[model samples]
Target: MGIFDFLKTKKVNDETFNSSQFQNEILAFALWKFNETNDYYKVEKELWGIQDFDLSEKQIKIIIEKLKVFNEKKN
Candidate 1:
């Protein structure tokens, strides 16, 4: 099995950890890429496929907030 194959296992209540986990992983990957590129718009477009162009400090904060929310929601 793959390293992350454990994600498919049944939890205590048999509930599946679905897309939320996957989204959190993707967001983490995007964050790592953002650190490298430092181009929010380009990283959003290339990594997350978000068609946003607001490259302001507020936008960066929003992205970070999204990552935090997704991470917190992850089991």
Candidate 2:
């Protein structure tokens, strides 16, 4: 890892990635990732992206609960 790498950033388009949209997109992507392989480890990376995703408290609870259900079903 280089110090300069910390300076790098990815920009979201002005029209595409506002707060609510970012959350929705991350959730959507995580759901798709989960569906793709049914692997929690892989899905977790997407969930980390979702920490940057702006979400309401209610939304967080709902999403986490859904994830729990998914894992329970998988096990």
Best of the candidates, lDDT: 2
> TM-score winner among the candidates?
2
What is the C-alpha lDDT profile of model 2 across 1-75, one tens digit per residue? 887965555444545444676556666776788789777667665554553344444444555566767567868
Quickly count the clashes in candidate 1. 0
Write model 1 residue lDDT over 1-75, tens digit each, in one string: 889966553321212213466446646766687668765566556543433222334444555567556546863
Q: Give the poorly placed runs of model 1, Cα more than 4 Å off.
A: 1-18, 48-75
Overall lDDT per candidate, in order of appearance: 0.51, 0.59
Model 1, residue 11: distance off in Å is 27
The whole-model C-alpha lDDT of candidate 2 against the native structure comes to 0.59
Q: What is the C-alpha RMSD of each candidate to the true structure, in Å?
A: 12.9, 7.6
What TM-score does prediction 1 earn? 0.38
What shift in Å separates residue 18 of candidate 2 from its native position after superposition? 9.2
